[model samples]
Target: MDTLSALISHAEPKANLFFSGNLCGSSSSTDHPAGGILHLVRTGEMLLFEEYGLTHRITEPTLIIYPKGKAHRLQPQTLDGCDVVCANLTFKDSPLYRALPDAIVLPLNELDNLSDTINMLFIEAFTSRFAQVAIISTLLDLLLLLVLRHLVENRICQEGVLSALSDHKLSKAIEIIHKQIDYPWSIDELANKVGMSRARFAALFNQTIGQPPLSYVTEARLLLAKKLLLKGEPIKSVSLEVGYSGSVAFSRAFQRQFGITPRAWYLKQH
Candidate 1:
């Protein structure tokens, strides 16, 4: 499977439309939200006020993304205000979310690759159409993917899984691991697969991914197992699917990682 597909499997993203219209006033801090906030400015001008007195005067069509919910304000600069589309971005708790920077602000022209998609989103937002909400939501999802692709290709993320995925050799190792999560993988084996010395691979993986290689494997397995268990799969089945030998071993590791037994966690969810 492609690296992005595999990565998305672990960090599936969802976007929900919250606002779309001409804005005449400033927005309050959005620190209370659960996920990230995305704003697409279609016209006019505005001022972005983020924490720590960080400010930007936005004069053109722009895309503003907050990967984590943060306290920020958006104020209109022009008397007529700006035409904007906004969405709430939610991602599964995974490396993708953890590795992202606090915020990304760029002109819409900078993402010319997404011009068609952006145009469609703007048109749909302002015009009456059938299934407009669903269409806009789907387009926002696509926009998220394209933005992530831009980050990866430009090596914008300085560290963590996205950074690792940007590295030619490390990405290969990650791809294989995601493809075969149930396989018992050793560090030496992964290093060899990626044609790197085991020692060098271990160090580089830690440097790029911010953790030991095997630790990541265990975390990946447990995270996947957690999702499976939540889907009502039996613990034993989830265990084996995530590479554990038995439910006992899986439960023990799960407890170690999560501070609770699988049964308890499952019960709490329900």
Candidate 2:
């Protein structure tokens, strides 16, 4: 897969719709974490105040995503009509998170491409009919994908994994590393694959990705190892699968990276 697809594959993002209701008076929401908060305004209007004292007025049929999870307050404009659906989004930790903004607001006009999905979400949320939960959950997932796509297409994310993928040379190198995590990758090999001199490639890769190329390879390997361990694979098997020759070497490297031996980490997770 390409770099963007590979990064997204590792992220394993998911969305959960937790609350849906109407508010008549002013109120504030509880502080959330970096995982993200999504708000779909179905009717009336509300004001969102950020921690920095900035405020945004959201009218009906608008979607707002707070990717940074800043603490904020939401108050209705009046005492009669503000309906909303709120959801929490969770995704695997990655540097890509840094590329996103504090919040992304898509008004009704901007959502023309997603009109059908947005409409379906509102319908499923308000009707509470058969399979409403499943339908809403699916729609929320679609909405999250839409938002990420918008960010990429608009070039709104200028750093982190997304930015690296936007570069031709770095993306090719990244794709190779992701596709061949088990291969013993050297800086020379990665640079050669991308048709660049080793020094030039190393410098550019570090500048674009904020880390050395081999460091990314190691991270990718460890991520794969973690997945294998979680699936009950043997330590030795995971070691070789991720390029380490033996369990002892793998255990040491894993411990250095995560501050715990693989076995201990697996047991705690289980």
Candidate 3:
């Protein structure tokens, strides 16, 4: 697993279809919750407005992703019409979620490699046959994955965890940490895994990821522990699951990381 794959695995993103239909001689505003939003245009044209100003003239088979869930307005350019499918993505908290931009627009030309997937989405949206919901749901999920791949391949994102994953050597180390959160890891061990000296690896990892290797590992472990705790796992089990030798040590670290005992945190969640 590379950094992108690890983050995606941890986030466990789910895409839910929100709306699919034609728009003509009308305008609509969509306010999305705190997640990602995707809009795929199958026909005609529309104008997207951000901050009450025209942002992009969405024509052709285009896909737009608002990774931060920024609210925007969309209106058909003419009475001739526009056909679109929109979906909302809910993701568990992860650095990849924060790495995405406010919005990304990929037109037909840019989505040439995904022509088949795009065509299928349009077909499913219009057919309205049996199991259409299930089919569309799967296609939307596929589309989101493709979008993430495209973003990384095109180097469109320049900051946050995604940017760090762009580095080949650093990505390898990140993958190891994510896959083996229960392992007793140290800066020297991580450095050796990536074939770098401790000092050099520390410098490069810090420079690229904005944190030291050990610090990143600690954060990753705590994140996994929190997720397990939220799932109603026992405190002792969660502690060992995240590499702590005992609950007392884990509790102290957890308090330092989150300012509350694991049991208290779990109670609040309930």
Clashes per candidate (backbone, < 3 Å): 0, 0, 0
- Descending-TM-score candidate ranking: 1, 3, 2
Q: Comparing 1 and 2 by TM-score, which wins? A: 1
lDDT of 2: 0.79
Task: Return whichever of 2 and 3 wins on TM-score.
Answer: 3
Q: TM-score each candidate.
A: 0.94, 0.85, 0.89
lDDT of each: 0.88, 0.79, 0.81
lDDT of 3 by residue, 1-270 (tens): 667888888776778888888867554435544467888888898888887688998877788877767777788887888888888887766667756788898887887778898899889998869999999999988888887887887778876567767788788888898889889999999889999999999998888777788777877788778778877889999999989999999999889988998889889988
Model 1 ranges with Cα > 4 A deviation:
29-33
What TM-score number comes out for model 1?
0.94
Candidate 2: Cα lDDT at 241: 90
For 199-223, candidate 2 gives per-residue lDDT tens digits of: 9999998887778888878877887
Which stretch of 10 consecutive residues in model 3 shows the poorest summed lDDT? 25-34
lDDT of 1 at 7: 81
lDDT of model 2 at position 58: 78
